[model samples]
Target chain A: MSSVAVIDYGMGNLHSIAKALQHADSSVAVRISADADVILAADRVVFPGVGAMRDCMQALNETGLAETIKTVAASKPLLGICLGMQAMLSDSEEGGITRCLNLFDGHVKRFAEGLADTEGNRLKIPHMGWNQVHYKPHPLWFNIPQDSRFYFVHSYYAAPDDAEVTVATSNYPQAFSCALAKNNIFAVQFHPEKSQTVGLQLLQNFLHWDGAL
Target chain B: MSLAKRIIPCLDVDNGRVVKGVKFVDIRDAGDPVEIARRYDREGADEITFLDITATHHNRDTMAHVVEQVAGEVFIPLTVGGGIRTLEDIRRMLNAGADKVGINSAAVFNPEFVRQAAEKFGSQCIVVAIDAKKVSAEGEKNRWEIFTHGGRKATGINAVEWAVRMQNYGAGEILLTSMDRDGTKSGFDLLLTRAISEAVSIPVIASGGVGNLEHLAEGIISGKADAVLAASIFHFAEYSIAQAKQYMQARGIEVRL
Candidate 1:
């Protein structure tokens, strides 16, 4: 059976993603491992995280998983989730200019304070709850429909330098990059494990995707 | 489209089973938290909240199991409230696959606990549940006070001010429950909801006293809450999560269909 390694650098939803992946496909074995060699040996890689960007980077660097992630991003089918997605960017403004993995050409920015919707209701920060994703064609999206709502809980969003790299966008007060795709790597700012049926479907798609353009 | 206001079906769990009676006539067991959670998830619930009212230490273990089971298959965000007093407690719930944990009385007793939990676990997972009651005279400037122990004890802290304090302390969201109207089935105290919602920069989930579908809509339009949480109305089959979303959509509020 094929297997995937969920890089566990001691931050974010480790057990949840592993279980969701197995639930998404029983044929695939999901392992949450920090060992660089064990992770690189897997068929695919899933980098998931929650919490602040700074602490996440600290753990990844200290555990030597940061180098492991860069190697995987360039070599195989890789999925980055939430803070994991943010860390793929060049740098994040969170915790005062924390350097990310720089896997993608983008910068993470915090949502401006006192933002409101068309109805003028003050939009809250951290952007918690469900939001619709307007996605472009990608193998990862598969059967997930356009404008499908996904769960989001973050204070900052990715601002990719190249518009072509952004595969999906969601609105808080303005359109922002919520999903990105490049050769061998697919990243999302939403939690597919926590997104219910459509989320599971996305995981299944990733399990089957061969990372070809 | 923009972010949709969330409609969450809250379950009061005790000893691992749903405390409140559920009216799912076709489901095998109405009291099973996992079953009810699955039902709600299928009905398009934006999120599911389990208000663990279990008091005994051993029974709390059962709730953890319940969360684990639900988190494995249910997929949507799950928040466990009640008796989450320590970092260890928060860690246990998160390890069990809970997306977040709600802190209530513990936040009132030691405000520092909220700060510590936020730092240790991240504010995104630390939800400060504020139970508030109207304390001012009918004609005077409206003011509400925080209550604890299921609204039986007053903390003498102002609700709006406390919301700001929690936000400053790094609470990601405020699960504000209006104790005055919790079970009244009348409606949410819109005054209380808007006050705290505006005071805090984080998301506010308006809870308590949701009698009908319109009350849920009212929560967003009038209360300015980012989300609405209800127990009896959803628990008793008064409305399904899909129907509530449609109602909010009709009222021109964005909701997941």
Candidate 2:
């Protein structure tokens, strides 16, 4: 039986993600584990997190899962969700610019304060709610339609130095990279577990993906 | 593109079953809470709010089970409220698969609970539900007052001021409900809804008195609410969530269509 490990680094809604994965494909075995052995042995790895970058990095560093994640990223298909996506970058501006995993060449940035649309109405921070995701050809976007709506709830977003890694973009008044992909790694700023139908399709795609670029 | 204005269908669960009533009285059984939630999700509900009206310790486990079941089938965000008093309670709900936990009476009685919950589990998962009623007592200017205990007890706190306080205390969103307009279906308390929405920077979900799709649109255009929550209209299948989204989309409001 195929097994997928959802890394639990003392952050994120591990239960919700695990349940969503099982629901996405009932045959796949989904396990929420922090142990390195469990993660390495699984056919795929999903890194999911939320909250401040400082605490996220703190928990990851303290638990030594940082090294385990990097080790697994080299061979297996790895998917990062929300903060997990941001953490894959070099650093973040949150909490006085904390450094991140640096798996991909990028930086996480906070949405500029006082941002507004053309109508001059101030946009709320956290960018909470559904926004359309425009994607390029990729395995994760296999069956999902173009410009599909996904749920997003974050104040900061990933800005990769190399635009080649960007797989999808979304507009929060301005376009930002919502999904990034390089070789075996795939990451998204939106919450697929909370994104309904299209999201489940993406998760299902990830389950069958072979970690190819 | 702008953030879509959300239309949330709320399920008032009592002992694991969905129930609806007028002004929180003469309650009638609607259906299974999880099944109703699943239906709303498929029909294009922006989100779902589950309020445990019974609020008893004995039924807490049952509520969690319902949340687990709903969370498994429904992919949209779920906010569970009622009888949430402590941080542990919030943690329990989130662990049980709820995306967000809505605190009402506990937050009014002890404002610090809001701060602590926000601090512990990011504000995104912490929603403060305020049940407010307009006070037009002699010599006092018209002001909405906060009510607790399922809108039975009144607190002298000003609704708008309390909303601001909750935002300042690190609440990510405010679920503002008008007690007077709740079951009346006359229309939302636009005055009260607008007051709280304008008072806080965080997202405000206007609740109560939604009789039709136009009322939902008014909640966004007139009340300035980021989202609108309704129970009866949806519970009885009077109007599907897709119809409401189509109505709002026609009115130039961005909805997930």
Residue pairs clashing, model 2: none
> For residues A1-213, what per-residue lDDT tens digits would candidate 2 score against the true structure?
899999998885788899889989999999999999999999999999988899999999999999998998899999999999999999999999898999999899988877766765557776889999999899899889899899999989999999999999998889999999999999999999999999899999999999985
Model 2 residue B197 CA deviation (Å) reads: 2.0
Put down candidate 2 lDDT per residue, B11-130, tens digits, no spaces: 988899777632211223346776677678878998999999888997888999899888878888999998999888888899989999998988988999999998889888989999
Q: Model 1 chain B — which ten-residue stretch has the worst lDDT?
A: B51-60
Pull out the clashing pairs in model 1: none
DockQ of each: 0.87, 0.71
lDDT of 1 by residue, B1-257 (tens): 78889999999988888877665976789899999999998899998999888656887788889999998888888899989888888998899989899998999999999999999889899889999999999899999999887889888999999999999999999999999999999999999999998888899999989999999999999999999999998888988888898889999998888
Q: Rate the local accuracy (lDDT) of all candidates.
A: 0.91, 0.89
Off by over 4 Å in 1: none
Each model's TM-score, in the order given?
0.99, 0.95
